[model samples]
Target: MSQISEEEKQYVVFRLGSEVFGIDINKVKEIIVYQEPTHMPGSSEFIEGIINLRGHVIPIFSLRKKFNFPEAGDMGKTRIIVVEAGNSTVGIVVDGVSEVVMISGSVIEKPSSLLTSTVDENYITGVAKMESGLVIILDLEKVIGRDMAEAI
Candidate 1:
């Protein structure tokens, strides 16, 4: 059987366009300034390409494209949030990364089924209610998908 903990969870918040989203802090490796990735032929459209981070070649994907957000204008605010999912590490491009915040798990509510029509509900673990606004918590595994994660 599985158990649920009431412990507070930390998340790294980021902006895609006008919307703000959050990812589990444990999955995040690091956040770096945006850099143009080398284009790879015949790869997925969302896959911006790859970059050599330190010594490792990491594939970078556009979270805006994946989420159907408009292309970013200012590169200055852009950032690449490198995250470790499963056995591979991938970088996700975001408009900007805000401060990390801790919130009790009890404050997270399961996403409504209606959201499935606009977004793949599987990608969203839950919705966190914050004083500022609602923060959509992303399930990195589901957001990247098993096939893509394996390919990375």
Candidate 2:
């Protein structure tokens, strides 16, 4: 089997409140325009509900609520990023997608212990230092949680 090169990694950068965050590009299936989700009874607060994508029912999650960020105001730039986590295809809502960046593995550092207070450290894989700014790399598996993924 061919191995993935560690020399560089591509990430899909997005905004959450004032901070920037990224996810592995390979995990992202597509980015779609924001649409109101149909609320599901007895779902978690972070779970914005589900959307019918083509013939598939995809669960939508609000990253702002998941990260404890204040509710967003304008919806103009909002987007739903469809990602594959485990066996589930989930859509994560973000303020907006910035750009796709390819950064060398050297610039990525382990998450600092201090960040645990602001956000769950388990959800963060690393912090990437880029020319634009720091991007908090998220562990999609942890963010999507095994149980939640299975349920969806």
Candidate 3:
């Protein structure tokens, strides 16, 4: 039981197009319904803009656009997952949030070279082999860090 618990990690699963991705649950703050953000002029293309959440203005980025996926129009199922990336708080827009699942570390595998070449490998932590399908675990810090660095 101890061994199982040690190997199990909780992830917040979300969808982008048909692909599923996950982030460490501990990094997530909250999930909110899709809301149009106030447009910020001269921001990055991937940035949807900023929204005031409980008095704190949080910038929202579209994972689909960042990943170069085609724009999906299913706004009803869309969600914004607020997460802590490095020292700052940011929100990532996903197609939809599925569930929080506990996956065993033993079943997590290093991402393949093909996948790495397609998408910046730095963003990928690992790929979890689930009974339904694979869930790519993302390092949001690495993914958002580059953009933040560029802005600075």
Q: Which candidate leads in lDDT?
A: 2
Q: Model 2 scores what on Cα lDDT?
A: 0.86
Which of 1 and 2 is the better model by lDDT? 2
Model 3: pairs clashing at backbone N, Cα or C within 3 Å: none
Error of 3 at 68 (Å): 0.4
Ranking by TM-score: 2, 3, 1
lDDT of 1 by residue, 1-152 (tens): 12225679899999877788999999999999999999988788888999999999989987777877778888899999999877789999998998899977777777887744456788888888899898888999888866465445
Instruction: Give residue 22's lDDT in candidate 3 (0 to 100).
Output: 93
Clashes of 3: 0
Off by over 4 Å in 1: 1-5, 115-117, 147-151
- Cα lDDT tens digits, model 3, 1-152, are 01222378899999988899999999999999989998888888878888999999988887887878888976889999999887778889998999999998887877776766546777888888799898998988888877755532
The models' CA-based lDDT, in order, is 0.84, 0.86, 0.84
Model 2: per-residue Cα lDDT over 1-152, one tens digit each? 12223579889999988889999999999999999999998887779999999989999987788878899999999999999988888999999999999977778777877865667888988888788888998999898775465445
Residue 51 in model 3: lDDT: 93
Model 1 / residue 105 / CA error / Å: 1.1
Q: Which model scores highest in TM-score?
A: 2
